[model samples]
Target chain A: MMVSLARKTLLHEWRRFLPAMLAVSFATLLQLLQAALVLGIFGGAAVYVSDSNADLWVGYPGTQSVDQGRPIDGDIASLLEMNPQIESVEPFYLLDGDWRGGHGTGGVSVFVSGVSTRPGAMMFARVLTPALRARLAYPESVIVDPADLNKLGVQVGDTASVNGHLVRVVGTARGLRALGGADIVTSLQTARMLDPAPSDSGGPTYLVARLRHPAAASSVVADINGHSGFGRYQAWTAPAFARLSVLFWLFNTGAGAGVLFLAVIVFVVGAIITSQALMAAVAASVNEYATLNALGVGKRSLRWVVLEQAFWVGACGVVLASVLAALLIWLAHSNNVPVAMQPSVAAACLGLVMALVAVSGLMAMRSMQRADPATLLR
Target chain B: MPYSNTVIDPNPMLVAENLTKSFTSGQLSTRVLDDLSVEIGAGALTLISGPSGCGKSTLLSILSGLQAPDHGRVLALSESLQAMDAKRVEAFRLHHTGFVFQGFNLFPALTAREQVQLPLQYMRLSAQEITRRADEALAEMGMAHRQHLRPAALSGGEKQRVAIARALAKAPALLFADEPTSALDAANGQIVIDLLHRIARNHGTTVLCVSHDPRLISHADRVLTMEDGRILDDSDRGAR
Candidate 1:
């Protein structure tokens, strides 16, 4: 009955609570979108490793993280393939190259990932259909995300100059989303054409190693690292490398801190708005609460009523936010904004909102405590 | 018949002993009740009358277990109200006490029936029984036709009647009214006073009323007049 009374009272005075509802909804929307965008950036940073078929990766020595390492000798691929636990080691090159837009405008950053022209030798081969995979055989031909066409001012058939070398766009990769700039996948020969002297000639950024025993890949990495003869090189299982990349982007750069700081400010503002609105509602109903106290309702029960009110308000806000977030995710996907709306992020945001409202409820309890039955006698 | 302060009343339903209550706002302090003692009998309408600021409401508040005295104790139906903890006192009030205020004090959002059902909801009664009893109380208050109306839709007298119905719905052993008719017209005040009298006489519920209206004292079975936080006269018209 106490809960029912609380619910009924809130519904009865919903007009008074509308401001609180809007505040909560706005907070939830901003938090969800910001967090989702950050997670999306992290996903984009680690996409090369996460979506790859290789179990182990090799990078230059003192490589603190992925996408930040120098090119290692391409011979490391043959040396890694000599291990009994290793299957095939493929040479891969990733570099940020300057590109001239189709309209001959200023230079724009383009990420060029170079792989073997042979089928099944590239990271994206697994995600591509056989028709698209077969097209990898054509030299100087590269794949780009369709969303990047407008960003690069180039279409599927347009020719663009990369590092002052011309390259042909053959096909589009559906899920090859990038954060800082457009991503292009090309054959090793074409990548060499674009940048003839990348570190040493014929050297690749990393050597991706497939494994005979996938689960034992980390142990193999440890064994390979123990060998001092492999100079200026570090070996890592793919997932560990992905984690390094995510951490590098999250804490090593200002992007993560900037997003997190904005989220915290939003959370605090949301909590204050909600708490003040609820306190106002409680103040308005002080006389009714005092009458309840005089009629023998416990102070504890009265607190529960206020807490329940906050809970319902939070719950309704979250529901509305979820719907709004779903629409935002759809629009982002259609427009290729690269936002990751992980279910775990949504759950965490829900917990945050509940905590915010619960604290507000506790703050509102102070008003209820002052509801003196003696006031009613006056 | 006039009763002396020294005389003990028999078969008392409530008793107050040397209750001293004082209010302080900064340096200014006022003693509302100074060593006051009183006994109220069951199944009667007892009216406490005084001019404004004579401590009538304070005494009512302390006696009804809504406020505590600076010193002294209250015993209602042989239970030590002052000795009990806050939770126990709340339970005691829930089971034994009902209150009506001069302002009606009804939840403006609730209909008359819901206001009457509020107390019964705390009693752990079944929904059917609570509804039945609340409807019965409303009917008895002559508000059967207006049970669906909120306080804003009701007149002052009608709002007071709903407040009375809410008090009566719980079937309390003691009913306390703090100027129940002070906000009404003469006709409505008389109607409320008559209804309170009927409730006390017919249901055997002890009704304690705090008022300054001389017109109301005539309807009381007993009248206690207070001055300077002390009872100056106690007249038992029922005994007469």
Candidate 2:
């Protein structure tokens, strides 16, 4: 009887609750996507940050992100190396190179990163795996994310030219997208051959110095400025560089504020739907609640029923949102969209939905409690 | 199909001492049940026959521990009704007291059998026990065939019988009916009154009925009339 009664109550409120639930679920899905993208950006940042091995990046102190392919020669690298606390300074062949391929498309913008032959075996330990290491080890090699495989139209054995310097597609690693474009990692030797600069000096455009402590990047940077002949490029920590990337993304694309504004819109739409459903349900069963109370079901029990109903609403909404969000993400991923999915971010999305559910519940709780048990007597 | 709950005192079937209630609508005040007292023997029907606005329902609720009297004490089966807390009172009502309301308070979603099992939730009984007791109660009320029907599907007489079956399913030591026949037709009302007398006589259960139906007075073992919540007329006293 109880189960059936509960089932009927569910049916009765389905009309109002279902729509609100879907709205909430869609909101949840959207929020999840936001979380996934944010986490991916953060995760990618962490991975790149940990790999840099430098205390500080010495840029021109101008833009937030994008090193601008600034070149620092061997003199500064040697000067940083002479520091007591400095371990070693290595320059990379970093440039904004364009790729020209395909049947119709003329060119594609890309960041050509020329890293050390064996940069930090400690940090790139995963990349050093026989399978992956073999790919990056080849002087004629290049790597891109799975998503880029379609755009670049290349496989493991395929070859492509980076700024007229042809390279083989050795392997594909997921992620490693920089500013929605692919990052092509190549050897310093290969970078020297390809870049319109000297390679024996160290970095073609960007110079990264590794320190014994790593934290002493500031002092090491100063020593490089004073002693090394080339001191135009500034040094920065990996995290600082990441913050620069975010700043660049925010200012350049308007993605952050746009997403946050969308979230606000979703929340309002969901709350309005949920409030209407709750109010209608309360009115429909006002007398029923009174009868239940008169039957000795206390206010506390009554409260549980309302809360349970809210939980039901939240659960339904979240599920619906997940479906919608997944569809949206898949659509983007299929259509070559930069939507990233992360587990921690999905959980955070659920948390946001629960918080919204709590707010909606708070709005309806008072009316549920004013059941007035004596109403049945009338 | 018999289920028993231990009555705290287990001596007196029902007892109420100095029960009082007051109703005040702004400045207008009416003192109802002013220190009224009553005691009825077990296994008998005590019909409280009173005019309208007599506070019969108020006194009944107070006695059932659903409502607390401003000045009174209720000792049911010798146990102090006023002593138990809200939860205990509800449990007491669940296992020991049967109630038949003026309107058949059937939960629209439930079948007739399920209506009989509502009180069993308080007992926390097994599903099988609840089912068996509900079936037996329905059978006793001649509602065995209608067990599958909901109130909306049943007639007035059938609904009343279902209500009685629900009350009887508890196997209460004390049965309370507040204007039970007011919603039924004359034919069905008489049938219900007769059923109440039969229950008290056959099961040795005390029945207290509060109603204005004079026809029901004849079926009661003892009848009392209340004016403004105070008992004024007693036919049993003349008989005794």
Give the candidate number with the greatest TM-score: 1
- The per-prediction tally of clashing pairs is 0, 13
TM-score of 2: 0.69
Q: Work out how many backbone clashes candidate 1 has.
A: 0
Docking class of 2: incorrect
Give all candidates' CA lDDT scores: 0.84, 0.69
Tell me the tens digit of each residue's lDDT in model 2 across A112-178.
7666666353323344344664557678777766667666656677877777878887777655566
Residue B57, model 2, lDDT: 76
lDDT score, candidate 1: 0.84
Q: Model 1: which docking level applies?
A: medium
Off by over 4 Å in 1: A1-3, A50-56, A61-64, A73-89, A117-122, A125-127, A150-153, A193-195, A198-203, A209-240, B1-9
State the lDDT of candidate 1 residue by residue for B1-240, as single tens digits. Answer: 322122224778899999999999999999999899999987789999999999999999999998899999999998889899989999998888889998887776788888888878878989988988898999999999999888889999999999999889888889999999889999999999989988887788889999998999888889999999999999887777
* Number of the predicted model whose DockQ against the real structure is largest: 1
What is the per-residue lDDT of model 2 for residues B97-175, given as tens digits with 9 covering 90 to 100?
7777776766666788877776565567788888888889899889999898878899998898988887787788888
- Across A1-378, the per-residue lDDT of candidate 1 in tens digits comes to 322767777888898778778888888888888888787777788878876788998998767666786888776766787799998888888888887767756788888988766666647755566577567577778888887777777888778888888887888987777667878888777777777465654688889988988999879999899877655689999988987888788887788789778878877888888888888888888877887788888888888888988998888988898899889978987877778876888898878878888887888778887788888886
